[model samples]
Target: MEHRYLGNSGLKISEITYGNWLTHGSQVENDTASKCVHAALDAGISTFDTADVYANTVAEQVLGDALKGQRRESLEIFTKVYFPTGPKGHNDTGLSRKHMMESIDGSLRRLGTDYVDLYQAHRYDYETPLEETMQAFADIVRAGKALYIGVSEWNADQLRAAHHLAKDLGIQLVSNQPQYNMLWRVIEERVVPTSKELGISQIVWSPIAQGALTGKYKPGQPVPAGSRATDEDGGGAESIRSRYLHDDKLTAVANLEPIAAELGITMAQLAIAWVLANDNVATALVGASRPEQIASNAEAAGVTLDTGVLSRIDDVLGDLPETDPNKTQSPATRLT
Candidate 1:
């Protein structure tokens, strides 16, 4: 896989990162997850992204086991904090010092690692002081618990404040993880510019818009049997509906089939390549339940879309993509 420096940091990560969000513990069996992880490694993917809250912390354990026996230095493992992993308690959530300190230890124990390459704040903590949160992150770095720090789904202002604080604290905040895809351009308006000015690159998720851009969900057909849209218990179907499951969006996506055919790639690869076309995007994160999915996505690592194909994509998906800066919102209360 192709690799790129994460923002201005010296650390280099794969252009296609394998992420285990809904699949590791909740959607697939452990053996299946291991196969997928092996497939990623076989495809030369060196970066893996997970979160402590994924599947109530079981995802980390599964990923840890799957990654066993590889040279740790050859891989970059990233995990996040800020979501409640245990019972509801005053100190169980948020980016408070107590929670941040305790969460790192728990994540290390579960991941079977002494230190993570990157530790990210899963969301902006509205309840905690930014100073307290950043100070805790600085401490984590000083204690050698994590090497670099990042944030996910943070607004431009929130990212600027944290970036400034990280600089003052002598910490390297190098990346911001956001939902960026052909169908979702919310990060393009303000977040991308602010991040560029701050020397931060983006590790984007859901590049296929939860499989909608793959043209698997037809415009007026029943939801595909094994697709994410049909898996109500997985808790991702609703977001897919609100984002790209409508007839208008599906029809737009279907119009891209000829384009993908002309390019001699799958619609998924076309979508992933589109995301990677942005210079500020360091990596495009993909999650999979099966090994073949990773293989297909890894093909998009070094692929480039021509100007005409990109224009065709924009023409087909015109005005359907969400690009408003105000859409980058954090929850008023900490998510449990």
Candidate 2:
């Protein structure tokens, strides 16, 4: 797998990071999850991303158990804080000093590591003071709990404030994780340029638009039996249905099949390579429910799409992508 530096920091993560967002503890059995993790390692992916909110902290334990024997220094494990975990108590959410301070320790213990490579704020906490949040992150870094700091789904202004605060506190605010794919370009307008100015790179998730870009969901056909569109229990069925499941978008996405065929790669690989073409994108996070899925997705790591193929992709999906910069936002209030 190819590796790229996260933001301006010295930390280099696999260009295709294996993430267990919905699959590890919620959507798949533990044994299957471990097999997928092993497949990622075998495919040369060293970075893993998870969140405490995923399956209420069960995902971290599953990932930890899967990666039990690897040399610690060879991995870059990332986890996030924000949203409720553990009984959904009032104090169980947000980025307050109490929550962040306690969350890091819990995360480390669950991941079976003394320190994480990157600790991220899963969302901007509208309820907590930014200073308090950054201070808590600074304390986590100084206490040797996490080496660097990051945030997910934060907007440009939010990133600038936290970046300045992190600088003042002598900590590196390195990356902002966002949903970026051929169909979801919300971060491109303001977030990307602002992050570039602040020296923060993007660790993008959902590069395939929840498998819509994989060309598996046909335009007028019934929903695939085992695809995410049919997984309403613990998967992303709702979002996939509401966003990209319509016939028009599916037809547009289908137009790219010939492009993928010409390149001798799957549509998923084409989707992933599209995101990596951006210089500001440090990594594209991919997840899988099966071991072979992980191995197949890893092949997108080094694939490159030139300007013509990129233009063809845009022409195929023109005006279907979400580009509203205001769409990138956290909850107006805490979910608890």
Candidate 3:
């Protein structure tokens, strides 16, 4: 497998990272999570990404139990904080120092780790002062509770502010996590350029666009059993993720099939390979329910897309509307 330096952090990571977003927590059994994690490790993927709020709190435990007996130093653990893990309250979540401090502890306990290789603020908290959030993260770094600090879903301005804050305070903010894929290029307009300029690497989530790029769902096919698209629950469960099923750009997926067929690869491989193809991407956080899925996802790490194929891909879907038609907006040409 190929490896890349995580931004300018001096940390080298596998291009593919196993993630437990929809598969762990309560969506799949512990045994399944274990199989996925080990399969990823065996396939040479060395990083895992999880968030505090995934599965309402069980994702981390599932990961921790899965990693048992594995060489801790051989793998990297990344977890995010900021989303509410409990009922809404002023102190229940966000990047406030109070919440940041407690959230790290809770995450460590659940992951069964003493230190996270990277601890991220899920996003900018408009209600909390940036200074408080930076200072809290600095403390976490100083205390050796976290090896590095980062943020997710943060805007370009927020990223600039955090970079300077960390520089002045002598702390390192290593990477930014964002949702980036052929199906979603919003980050490319601003976030990707900023991260590239700031020397911060981007670890992309939903790198597969929640399986939309997998090409398993035909436009009118019934949602598959045990698939996230059919779920009814909304608390970070597979059901909760079905909202993406309504995504506007999924029509774009159909355009790539002929190309995927030409490459003798599944749409899934083509989509994942597209992410890895970008030099700006550091690691792709992949999700899965079975061991084979992890293995399949990892193989994409080596699929190279030449210039012509990339150009064809761009010509097909690069002009998708900004607001995600499945979510809120219309085609770009009609937008005022």
Candidate 4:
């Protein structure tokens, strides 16, 4: 797998990061999750991204157990704070000092690690003051619990404010994780430019639009059995159904199949490569339920799509992509 520096920071991560979001401890069995983790490691993916909120903290335990024997220094493990975890108490969520301080300890205990390579704010905490949040992160860094800091789905203005605060607090705010793909270009207009100026890189999630860009979900056909669209409980079925399940989007996605065929790669690879074409994107986060799925998606690490190919892809997708920068936002209020 190809490796790139996460931001202006010296830390480097795999271009294709293995993320266990909707799979481990929720959608897939533990044995299957472990096998997928092993597949990622075998494919040279050393970066694993998970959140404490995923499966109500079971995902971290599953990932830690899966990665038990390898050299710790050889891997970069990441977890997030915010979102209610552990009994969902009043103080169990958000980026307050108490919640962050307690959440880091819980995350470490579950991940079976003393320190994480990166600790990210899963979303902007509207309830907590930004100063309290940054101070908590600075403390975490000083305590050696996390080496770098990041955020997910934060808008351009929010990123600028946080970057400044993190700088003043003497912490490295290095990355922003957002939903980025061929069909979702919300980060391109404002977030990318602002992040590039701030020296923060993007570790994008759902690079295939939750498998819609993989050409597996046909335009007018029933979603294949067991696919993300068919899964209702823990499989992000609502997200896929509400976002890109329409025939207009599916038909546009299908038009890109020939581009993948021409490149001798799968539609998934084409989608991933398109995300990586942006210089500000350091890595594309991918999740898998099966071992071979990880192996196949990892092949997109070093693939390059030239300007012509990218343009053709744009032509095929043609305005179906969401490019409005305003769409990149966090919740107006913390979820209970």
Instruction: Show where candidate 3 strays beyond 4 Å.
Output: 86-89, 235-251, 321-336
Let me know the TM-score candidate 2 reaches against the reference structure: 0.99
**How many angstroms is residue 121 displaced in model 2 relative to the true structure, after the best TM-score fit?**
0.4
Residue-level error in angstroms, candidate 3, position 248? 8.2
Give the alpha carbon lDDT tens digit for every residue of 203-224 in model 1: 9999999899999999889988
What are the per-residue Cα lDDT tens digits for candidate 4 across 1-336?
Answer: 999999899999999999999989888899999999999999999999999999999999999999999899999999999999989999999999999999999999999999999999999999899999999999999999999999999999999999999999999999999999988899998999999999999999999999999889998899999888988887889989889999999998888888999999999999999999999999999999889999999999999999999899889888888888999999998888
Instruction: Name the 10 consecutive residues with the lowest summed lDDT in model 3.
Output: 327-336
Residue pair clashes in candidate 4: none
Candidates in order have lDDT scores of: 0.93, 0.95, 0.81, 0.95
| lDDT of each residue in 1-336, candidate 2, tens digit only | 999999988999999999999998888999999999999999999999999999999999999999999999999999999989999899999999999998999999999999999999999999899999999999999999999999999999999999999999999999999999999999999999999999999999999999999988888899989889898887889999998899999999889999999999999999999999999999999999989998999999999899999999899998999999999999999998
| lDDT tens per residue, model 3, 1-336 | 788888778788899999887779777889878988989988999999998888867899899999988888988999998877866466777788998898899999999999999999877777778899999999999999998898887777778999999988898887988777775667776777788898989898877777767876666566577666666675233522453454445667787899999999888888888988888888888888889998988888878999999999888876662433232111222111
Better of 1 and 3 by TM-score: 1
Model 1 per-residue lDDT at 64: 96
What's the alpha carbon RMSD for model 2?
Answer: 0.7
Winner on lDDT (2 vs 3): 2
